[model samples]
Target: MVSSDSQYSYTSSSDTELYSPAADIEHPSYISKILSKTKPDEGKARKSIAETHAEGIENTLTRYESSTHGIGPIESVLDEEKPEQFDVKPDTELNEWDPWHYPVDSETGFRIVQFVDNDRDDPRCWTTRARWNYTILLGLVCFDVAMMSAIITGDMKSPAAHFGVSLEVMCLCVSLMVWGFGLGPLIFAPFSEEFGRNRVYQTTLLVAVCFIIPCGAATNIGMLLAFRFLDGVAFSAPMCLIGGSLSDMWRNEERGSAMAIFSVAPFLGPVMGPIVGSLLSVKCSWRWVYYFMIIFSGCLYGVMFIFLPETHHQTILQRRAKKLRAKGDSSYRAISEIKTRSVKKIAKDTLLRPIILLSELIVFLVTLYMAVIYGLLYMFFFAYPVVYGEGKHWGDIKTSLMFIPLGAGTILGTLAAPFLNKDYVKRAKKYIDRGQIPPAELRLIPMMIGCWFVPIGLFAYAWSSYPHISWAGPAFSGFSCGFGFMMLYNPANNYIVDSYQHYAASGLAAKTFVRSMWGGAVPLFTIQMYHRLGYEWASSLMAFISLACCAIPYLFYIYGARIRERSKYAYSPVQGELKDPEQGIDSSAQDMRSNHQLSERVIDNE
Candidate 1:
């Protein structure tokens, strides 16, 4: 059974004002006898009516006048009178909308209502500057939540002591927090799809803040662990949602610079956490870490509340449909409103999407690569302090300072944005000049180049750090790690968003789950691995594994077009147009516009 909101309603065939069956035809004896019945069972049949009748229904045709005559007499007529097609909106002239009857497709099992044109009110139609500002606001929220993951990583010894728990288990609190990142998106991503990104942001982030307070005041490891896990769940929102949000804002060609800036949040939080945490751990105590988070989050919440706007076009259209209904345009329905699921089906789909997406080869391979990268980064959560503090005999502050190189490298890597997107920009222009659209694989070029750098950075970092070497050598290697990370990560994330199109949030959710699962799992044995294998070999091991996956990008570069051709989730062009079934708009025109902008940019530069 499909469930619908108050604004989205199903009408009955008996409502002829919307649609009426063919008239002026001789009725068969059985139909005529059923419609000719005058002994209406009004007392028995009044309770179970199939449709609500409108005033216009009574005046339009004989079949609908039976609503007042009693359902008994009209029941057969209503069945026979069922129209072949339906009008979703009534007040507007049917001719005003193109292709009025949306036939239910076999894939979705429900017909969809779609926009006749690119509606100005749609978030997809917002100005570029306005859209980007929203992306930045989303990035800050992600940064705020992710910063807390590193809050305790810099200095866990004292927290274990204060809590009176085994240091390993107490440290597991942070690991478990990372685990929550994997699990949260399973629900949040789907919830965002059903609701909107802005709703998930406010609710989850607020709850995550509440969880932090308890961590600061926890009486035991169990309490801290529980709160941390919930916090991870809350904080995981940015990982799954932000990629989709950015994709919603910009064309694939235009997303490179925005993604460069947006991708910085995940790194910034981790980098900031260590620095700020080291200071707080030295100056005050572990509890103060949570206190500091409270202050930062409190402020972030206020800013986002004011600045963040809903960006999902379907969500905006849903509200518009609701408003149109209130104004008595009952037939006006958004395409997204067509497919309603019961709570059970919703939960089933929401939970199963990530698993199903993971099975997709592109999602699987890329997610695995990112997971390895994420795990290596999480492993650094332990590796950083050990290599710098214990290995180099540095104090808390200096150990934290060591992380700056990684952050610096990532920042410098942002320089690769224009270069990375050079292919996309050029390809887009050629297409526009020829009045055509570029293929989706154009998004993957920079990513393919970036893929090689991961192994290079790993090898550099693995070999450079030694007891005798200057800290600068390892610090500089950290820059390679950061730069290589940007080279691959920005493009991979953007590729998924561009390829998946409307389902970008769910695609990112699958990635977040894979990324966070490995991210969380790495720290569990990172110190143990270091103890067993030593630093150079361990980092080398990771690098070689990365080297093995290096083919992932190249393979995609060569075969991604074919790979996505089989993808149910991929919104590749059918013929020459990338169709938005939800919008009923052919993105061919939109693509040309974006390419036109790309051409202007190229011309200006030339």
Candidate 2:
């Protein structure tokens, strides 16, 4: 029989021996007292059994890492007396479960871990960063306002009449600019990814200023149209890069508000352009519009060059790594080094992605619907004048002023977006908790509201333009249409972004292509549509089409997530998850390529 107070000893060889205290062992006096009351040596055997269990755990960790890395075998030095204990359950579970590695701060939800200086005087404080970010957004807004002022000049009827050009020819100038704007992104987006955001912005703005100067000096319609198209190309760089720049600075939670403010500029610019252009054209030639834009663009270029630092995390990290390498540091590899693809390959892939996404069934259908909506909205630019001028006897300035209601509606819609987004997020969380699948259709609530109002506004605008009704009816209609427009546009975009997380830029590019084409084509046909059907029937036809398009959002909202789940291109946990905040891209190159292929397959099936 084993003694109760015996300590266990093991021998590996004749020359080597190790001793350890047994788990159930106690002081000799306590063991003797316990033995007096209980069975002798039972505790000694139990303690030996505990020691054996600890030895089993130590062997497991050695095998686990060996299987994972396949690095031959793990040779860990362990003390004979206190051998390392590995929990087999934890090791087995860890091997089975794939770990998600991404740079995410749980407390702040910020992608990058910002090291803050405790000193109040430090420039890297949160307050300073916030202020700088606001300034950048403001600068972008000012740039948008300046560029849009040219649209009013392009939209003017008097200049086309003076030039003895047809309405179609005049509309072509606007169409060309829209075309240039859309096409410019295909080049600029990839270039920005290669070169930095700041470099692209400053260079493009300078090009814009140069082109605007030529537009101001144009003696013929040919010169004016040519310069305007070039200016449009130059201006497109800022539009593409600014959103990415904003993403670099703000976390996902803060991004919605920033996007709201950024979104307003494009809409407001066009609305305000006509107002400013009407007054400027009346007081001075349309030449002053170009001159004013040149001056504004120049000043903005100066300010942006001075203040806008390179905020792109990948570029910043790459530069830091380069500096460290120059100093002969061995540990300064960029996160992007792991994915060693050539720049040419990246460019080729980026260029093809947007085209591939455009071919997707859902993307194509949504884009077509969105394009028609956008075209119909711009068509009103021409239609409003005819209804107000012929029907109500208003001048160009007064006709342009009528767009104020449209701007007002956009403001109201923007204010409501955050509340709507919050509600949807909560609903999504609830669905997850209940083990029920959340559909993407929950995102279309605002879009449904838009569908109801858009047609009503179109009918109201058309019917009320007759001699019997007051002008207030048409104005109210415009306001209603504007509200509907915002509701439809925002949710559609958000849905696409959320669903195609890896291919968002390409998806947006696809949408932009279709939307821009519509914007270009619609105004050209507005005169013909009105002439053939009269104002009431023309707008009513548009309303009918809009009503048909309304079914799209409803279909997607109900079945979108199901479609996404089936889709190879859609966001997924395995391939689509973002890693490395410094690299700052959500989808990997492999995932993006896979998604593009999946999108093609879905399109082909459809």
Candidate 3:
């Protein structure tokens, strides 16, 4: 006899109520019908009752089988429309039978599951060790080469002079390179998302190498500038892709440390470039810089070709799905396969992000604050040489060497950043534990310290470079300014990255575009500014601007969380939730205190 106990019956009427047999509970098809008579909390009660009914049904099935045949039938459920019939077979027979004999499902599944949920903690996702290593290595190489090019191109004044180009024209070449770098992301970001990251990176790096080689052989300033712009375009691919690759490799918590290390290049490149370029320009022609870059780029290209596999999860899964489809299997699908949007729509959205971010009140203000600081810092590169050489009677080499203090300050600041970041988190957690409202504004402490030092250093550097003051005074100011620059940059960037969890790339690109534009433009007019205002008053005016920027960190420190709460783009407690504001000590603050202590100890030892 057919088992009526295991069967579930449904009526044809769509609005009819059905009851679960085990729990004797009824639920209506429409939620409105249930809510009309029941209170809101009663809906939850209905769900609990349905769950109990399911359990009772299961128990009843077990008991019926135990009381009757002592074992269940081996018959399998099959769709009646299908021709194939299930045949009982031995273990060896089943193994020998074609696994493909099973009928395919009518529905096509999605193709982008891997990309959507590639977290390590999730059982459905996993990335290989080799893939992670390759991502990081390729990222390092790509950024190193890109940054090196920016540094060398920016410092190629001697070559421009040799070519009879005015300094203004030469500086324009630098500005063009920066413009190319800024615009490159818009093109590459969407392309990487469309094509696989590895394919895009490999193709672009090769193009960059090709452009770099020709750059060394350029006969005129225009040719050199044209080649450099192309090179910038090629180099930008890696910068845009690396962040996504990092997200593929590491979890949210682990990403900060990785990003911190990756971020070191953009800062260090400028410092390292001038040091190396100064030596190269003095010993050899500026063309040798391009030649050197070509060699480095070529080596990196080979390394990436061998080591970098496609890590973009969608691409990986798509490849897997292709393999499955080739075998006549229909279960394969990618997460992105479900997306119905056209490529044009995706491109349009990607293109508008930087503009949209700039329009945001908070993002715009923060970006402006950071941009001014960055411009001022870069401007000092040009200003210091003129001040120290003409005003203090120092040689070109000696004036360039004065940047060592700035380098020292950057190193000290970078080393201290992790600890400070850790302390801020710890303190936020502490606030949470104590039942206090933890604030995102607590992150502004270092920024406050940094803002104060920025102006102080600018004023000191300006006034101390005169004939009366010793060179040590100006160098000390450089150190202080470098420290302040790091303080301002790190916190602002980290805060933004933390605030916009999914949109971090767009946020970073927005900030990077503004900062690079400022860096590119400021050097061109630095001499004019200094000449018009004289060093003392010119830097003093900059100091006043720095004073205004100090208010940014202060405002955020006070009202940051509230601002985040209202923001749709900003990461809220729901999305990779940040530490509760009140717990113990903010981890970032504690980290800063530790770093401060370490710095003091180092000074003491020195």
lDDT of each prediction vs. the true structure?
0.62, 0.58, 0.57
Candidate 1 per-residue lDDT, tens place, 155-254, comes to: 8888888877765676687788888877876656556656777887788878887888998999888888889998887877656666556655665556
Candidate 1 wrong stretches, greater than 4 Å: 1-133, 244-256, 341-345, 428-442, 494-507, 559-606
State residue 381's C-alpha deviation in candidate 3, in Å: 2.7
Count of backbone clashes, every candidate in sequence = 4, 2, 47
Choose the strongest candidate by lDDT.
1
What lDDT does model 2 reach? Answer: 0.58
Residue 344 of model 2, lDDT score: 57
lDDT, model 1: 0.62
As a TM-score, model 2 comes out at 0.72
lDDT of 2 by residue, 1-606 (tens): 221223332222322221122453222222223223334366564444334333332222221111110000111112232222321121111110101101222222222211111212112223646645654555464446333533553346766777788776777666777667766766665565445677887888788789888777877789878977787777777766665555455444555676566555666567677677777777787777677676767777887788767765445545654654465433333333322336555554456666777766667878887888778767877787778876778887888888889788777777777787788768855654443434446667888777777888888888887856888888888778777877887677666655674455456667876677777777678878887899889989998998889898888877776677777665533323444436534334333333322221111000
What candidate 3 gets wrong by more than 4 Å, as runs, is 1-139, 153-157, 392-396, 431-439, 497-505, 561-606
Best by the TM-score measure: 2
